[model samples]
Target: MLGRQQDEHVRLDHAVIGGNDLSEIDDAFDSLGMEPTYAGKLENDINHLSQLGFEDGSYFELTATLEPGQESPWWDVHMQKDAGPTAWAVEVTNIASVVDEIAERGTPVDGPNEFGRERPDGTYFEYELATLGTKEFGTQLPFLIEDHTPRSNRVSTPTPSVADTELVGVGAVVVGLGDLDDGIEVYRQAFDLPEPSRQTDEEFGAELAHFPDTPIVLATPLAAGNWLADRLETFDDGPCAYLLRSSDWDRTTERFSLTGESSWFDDRLAWIDSERLDEINVNLGVLSP
Candidate 1:
């Protein structure tokens, strides 16, 4: 188990969407009225781009392997499963303590590995990541990251001219699970997430276990006809969707229409189909001002 608890609270750093079709995914984001604030190449093997500047500090990262056969092990595994919005990352203040905690729990972690990328402006951004979920647990678990530099320096603020729709923060990350109890046990042991309050959504035909203190929600299909069930059937159990909060719901919906990407929208929520989002579900909901 993790060592004595530190004073830091777990916060989401970013969510990753990976695909081989870089240009297509880029175009899709563009069509959805989102503009990338920063772009960079990782080790000349992967391309990384971000649309940041959220008031709440969470960001979205779009990444793709540069070469056909020379993909990293992580990207290769994600692509083999479904390839879009594959991994999510959490920010931890003490990297070594977090790493030690996982190791002591019998989960062999790969790093406190340092990595960096060059910004378009020629400056470099560096950070250390401790990878927890591996071959044993599968790639669904989020890795822990600590930045050496200020996060604002790495992710710039989005201007109104560049961003038509405002993404305030991540409301929840929807994790698909084979067994709800097993999934809860794993996340609790790894991240110290609290016990979830369970509920059933009749509209989605799914049962949800909400961990209100954290940014994760565990989803399991009650039957075979719902969206969650279909996803669990097609892909391995992992992160399947992200519920993003919007600053202005109406304005965001108007922008969505301008993109002409097929999406479903109500007054409070919008669901962008996976076909338009690199096979990952993007749900946008309104956040109260």
Candidate 2:
């Protein structure tokens, strides 16, 4: 009977994509009809840029290491292996409570550490974060982010033209797990997340767990020769794709067509290949009014 309580403070914030080339990454997103804003340097080592703001308050961050061969934990852990979407962040209303909850569950927590980024206009945005679980979890468990400044100032609203397709928000993030039961237990103990609605998909030979009141779905491959199995082998059990919501599916498909990129879509949603998206899989679904 695990369910989301009203007091639960965590919500999806943003997902991070890492690359060595900034301009190339920016151009790729631009072709997707997204307007990116450069947020200047983060902690003085990583260059931060973000995509258009979504109604759900979730966005995408594209980052690149500014200092080559620098000993940066964020870059080394997330971006060192490949240039792709690697980590995600969650907004927490009360970080101390979250940290204490994790510690009570016998998981070693890292910071309550303060960090900030500057805008080109010279305004500074500050926040504190706490990391849950060990390095073994990698990008599977999102770090808790507590913002010190106004969220609007940190992420601007998107102004899309009538011809442009609107990216409404993130529907869910698809994460590949090493063990489905163990991953579920870890999330339940660490974050107190709601119980998931479970299903077995024969098409993919995977078990899917959709969490209540959250945009996270854990997938574990049940057999070989499936997309989940391929992702598990390639990314090694972590976030592999994001399910994005769009206001107009037709316009979004046309937008992808204009870029001369190959995409696959049905009546309900569209899938953009990772080769066109800086190695990140984007599944676009229609957003409800």
How does each model score on lDDT?
A: 0.61, 0.63
TM-score of each: 0.79, 0.79
- Native-referenced Cα lDDT, model 1: 0.61
Off by over 4 Å in 2: 1-8, 67-72, 136-138, 159-165, 201-205, 224-235, 248-269, 273-275, 278-289
Residues 1-289 of candidate 1 have per-residue lDDT tens digits of: 0111122545777777666655555666666656555466666555555453455666767666665444555656554443565677778888999889877776668889888877778877888888775532234577888988876656764534344446666655667777789878877777666787776656545677766556676778888767767666665677766666666666666655322222222114446543466443444333322
Predicted candidate 2 versus true structure: per-residue lDDT over 110-216, tens digit per residue: 98888777777888788888877774323778788888898776776443421234666665566778789998987887767778788765543568786666667
lDDT of 2 at 184: 90
Model 1 regions more than 4 Å off: 1-8, 44-53, 67-70, 80-82, 105-107, 135-138, 159-166, 224-230, 257-269, 273-275, 278-289
- What's the true lDDT of residue 145 in model 2? 85
lDDT of 1 at 42: 67
Write down the RMSD of all candidates, one decimal each: 5.5, 4.9
